[model samples]
Target: MSLAEAPFVGNASARRVHGFAAGSTALLVGDPADGSHLAEAVAELGLVPQSVSGGSAGDVLARLAREAAALATSGAAVPLTVFAADLRVSAVALLDLVDRPSARTSVAIAGPHEIAKDPSAFTLIRVERTQRLVHSVGSARHVVSAPNALAVGALLVAPEDVPAAAQLWAAAADDPWVDPALDPFDLALVALVRGGVSVSSVPLGPYDVRRGAGVTVGAAGSPWQQRLYGASRGDDGFFSTFAVRPLSRRLTAFGLAHGWSPNVVTVTSLGLGVLAALLTATESRAAWVAAAVLLLSALVVDCVDGEIARFSRRFSALGAWLDAVGDRVKEYALLAAVAWVSVRRGEPAWLLATTAMALTTMRHLEDGAYMDRTATSRSHLVPDRLDLGPARDLGPADAPTSLPGAVSRRASAVSWAKRVAHMPIAERYLVLALGLLTGSTQVVLWAITLTVAGALVWSQGGRTVKALLGSDGYERDARRVDGRWSDLDHETDLGPLARGAGRIAPLPFTASVVGVGMVAVCAWFIDTGRLPRVAVVLAVLAALVVGAGCRPSIEHRLGWQVPAALWGAESLLVLGVAATLPGGGQWCAYAYLAAVAWHRYDVLYRLRDTGSPSASWVTAVTLGVDGRWVLLAFLVATGASMQSALAWAAVLLTLVYGAESAAHWRAWLGREGALRSEVARREAEV
Candidate 1:
């Protein structure tokens, strides 16, 4: 038999009772303690009491409903009872079984105190129609129970003095347990349960206990969980949101209008540099002024191009590479013009040598360290990562994604220097004015070129070095796998120079050599009638000794032996020139100047063209040693001469030309060397 058919038993004098009959059940509801006592009294009746905790509102309702339904459907001819201590459960879940046609369910309210506290509770029980099993057996006028002594006592009281149950209920409503302020829905549910209304078993409308707390109770099959905590989510949306700014917008617009491609700007700057050099070679003040303007304009354009590319989001690797290469070329051209001027002025050799060394060092430092194609090689001035936080928060909706957020701070020294160089035109023009006041227009031009060239060199050089060698010294973490210093063989061809002397134009080349020969012959012509023949011999010997001694690798191998020989030779030339007549003296000076210029040009060109160690050696010697000595000599000579002003002018011009020429000649030599090597190897193999 089903458990619902089980028998029920309880004390006859108890405030409540329960039993089961065929297809029906009865429930006696009352105070919880009294209900338990009644159940114990029913031990002889063969019924067991089972209690379940009603921890939450939902739990309580569900429990009440299940117990009520089982009792209503039982087929056994027995009675079962359910007792609840409180009306916490809603009326619906408790009374759902009353509608069943196959069973009868009854509810009876016990305990006078309980009935008075909640009059509606009593009304709900009275409305239900299964067998009423009221232990009190009270009439509407005067309620009575198994012990009638109390009722008889109440019946003797004066009618007007009789305490109404409503008054007791009103007083009890003040009690916390009989909360009158309970939610209306909860109150209604309690009333239905008490009234024994058969509730239809509609599924619980989604349980939402956390609704008042503003917490969403997600459905079992919902995707909210995935959205809140999921992997493989991209940050594209975040970055795009960050990229919107007024400055960025303005820069982008300007970039588009200016047609300022980074690479184009770089190449243009290089062309301007070449033009500047060519103009400077004319030795005219107007030409110098023009060259200065062109150089300045080129620099301005160069600065704008990068700014445009960065702001407009059009930056590219090739453009950056070209910009770097172009800067080197520009410097070379400008300096080469200065060197050509030195050749015309007959300056001493040491000045050119110093300039060459300085340029080479600066360029190498920049190229090797800053732009070495490795992250480690990149300069510390620029950050490896871009800072996109501000942009992300305020960027346009459709901005490009995948932007990094670790931009270099703008306060780096290199950045500051660049800003200074690219300041407003007014400031730069002011600098130009100052240069003009301090020196000749030509001097100002050289100064301007040198200043710009120096600034560029420092900026790029520092950056390149940092890039090649990481701040932390981690070789494996280098950015480029195949940089300039990498072990892999990466030979660069120097184009036309590699074809050798055969391919060179006969007239111009021959003219240059012939010019040197003529100058030498002129030296002999001046020497015969002026100073002694011995002095002439000594001067020629000095040129040979000093020129050959300047080669570093050879000197290093030969120790100080070459230097001593050159010193002896120079002593003789100085004594010989001092003793010569004025006419011969000039010619002697001119001769020595020619020899120095020719030797310098030849050494630089050969080294650059052939990639010979000797070329580098010569360059180092001339720039570091000979160049400084020549400057000193010019200073001394000017200080002692009656034509000091002329001498000074001559010296300044010589310094400018010597420095520039040495640099260009070296570059040419390097290029030529590579070209020659390529042609020789190719031809020999063929």
Candidate 2:
């Protein structure tokens, strides 16, 4: 393996580092007895630190500047981050300096002023890189030092700042007043301050400390890591306060000293979670408690992975996807166990468990769809949950926030039951724990099933009722309000679909799922032979969208516009026919399908992306008649023995997709939906 890609292990005396984007930028470690202190700190922040040892600061700067200049000439570039390497310093504080969005020539710690030679003198903090010096710091507080002050040692010199920074280094030698062999701070003093440069003082509170392991491990309140623990907690409940957060913090401490990476921690948690699933399946009383304990441990470990990533600056694309997929895997595995137990107990509770599983997948699908729409439109601080990319990949999206500090402490639930239910991981595990302990897994399933089904229905239903009652124009710009994400139509899009047949461009992932899913469902329908040959042939045609949709002959001529919609429509119609032929409460099937389809349509209308609000809204409402829900509904319809009735309902509902798809093609092809593109263009211009 390349040295850069080699796994890091805890070796107290070794210099640890992570390099990025290839050309070298030296790490100027200020202390050696400290054992690559700055280098390790830099590495923790996901950057490789280089050993920069020269006789003096001037010598070091001269060398690095020359190298940078050489690279510039060769069409390559290397930017440098210099650290003081002091044990008293916290690496967390250097993050802003590293990623500082400033256009400054050079940055250094707002050092103690020369005139403030005595302890009582003002620090003379000057910041030229940002407007914060003028915008935030009040006229009254400039000279006076605050109580929780940080000693700054980090400096960032962006590539644009290199030429001027290099000039300062060269000029320092000729200036007789400035020492030739200068220290880093002294160089900052002359090269920046004396040279009429601007410098800003970063918050010192969570960044600097008294040198000792105890300084970090001492009080739960002293170190940045401890502060991070508090910051990382979601607006959660008792389990989060008493169980998850506390345990996670302690594990954070353990991981830091041992130099554990986020992926390693995540894998460990997954293993424990899997073991818990196994034990829960055993259905023994003692095993139940242990399963709960293991399950809880897995959660804490799951949380720890994120904590360590934030702490050590090791956030990676893999960590993002792993964190998400790992939870889904663990949750579903436990649910599968619950289902198995339900089946063995001769309880229909297995159905509820499976329903929860299906709902979870659907929930993520919608969330993924939402993220895809906003992917490049805004820069996210915590990143979209589905964005499986490195932190650096984030670009200016007209919006951003750091994830750790995102949750509001004021966020709360009204009742205890609701609070527990709202606690996400804590609640999930607590419920699982209680169910296993009480040997009343069915009760938990009942609660979860009701909750999931109710939420899916109520939230969207309520929004629809509200929208109908207090109607808003589909052309309204949701981005005008901070509540854009929560707006019913934020995630759905009409785009080219309804605009003119802008083409039924399902995201690649969604398309794959739809296609493969149809093939599997069609295969089952054919093998059952319960279907007529005509119906079976229709099912094959539906599967053709997935099975042969990729073939050039089919894709080029038909594309996905017609055939894909036909597949969704035909499949639903066949199922609905089969379901309703026996006529047992087929109206329920109609209502259910309508509710789901209307939900998607409502969302798509607000986000039709067309210029004419009326056209966009009407077209989206007409074109977004979804039958995908029939896929899940059919499972229940068939299982419930209301076959013919629901089957006929499915056929009626099937027309939604066909009409919607045709409408989308006609609208988009007719250029009626072209307004959506114009809207984006206007937004870009803004």
Among all candidates shown, the one with the greatest lDDT: 2
Show the lowest summed lDDT stretch of 10 residues, model 2. 134-143
**Candidate 1 residues 1-686, lDDT tens each?**
11122121111111011121212222222224323433332231224445534243333334444544454344333334343332222111122122111233233222222121223222111111111221121122112212110010000001121122112222223323333333222322232322323221111111111111112222222121111111111111211113212223333334445454556666876788678768766877677778767765555455545544432223343355456445545544555555555546664322332233233333333233222223322222211111111212122356333212333566444544454553222233334434433424345445544654565455554543643464423233234332232210111111121112213322222232232232233234333433334323433332223333222112121121222222222222332232333322232333333333333323223333333322223333333222322332333333444133223433544554456546754565576576546434433432
Tens-place lDDT per residue, model 2, 1-686, is 11122233223211122223123354553344366555655555555566655466556556555644554565544455555444334444444455322324333332222111221211223232213221011011112112112224455555665565566556653444444344443344334433433343543323233322213122233334433553354445667766788878777766766777788888998999899889877877688788878988888888888776655444444456466667766776787676666656665343356456544444433333333223322222121111111221123444222111222445433344455543355666666767667766786566555655554454334433543564411222223442122222233222222222212322322343454455445534533544534334434333333322332122111122222233334334434443433222333433334334433432333233331222344334433322232333344334544444444544654454445445544555455345435434433432
Query: In lDDT terms, how accurate is model 2?
Result: 0.45
RMSD of every prediction: 37.5, 16.0
Taking all chains together, each candidate's TM-score versus the true structure is 0.27, 0.46
The Cα local distance difference test for each model comes to: 0.33, 0.45
Instruction: Give the number of colliding residue pairs in candidate 1.
Output: 62
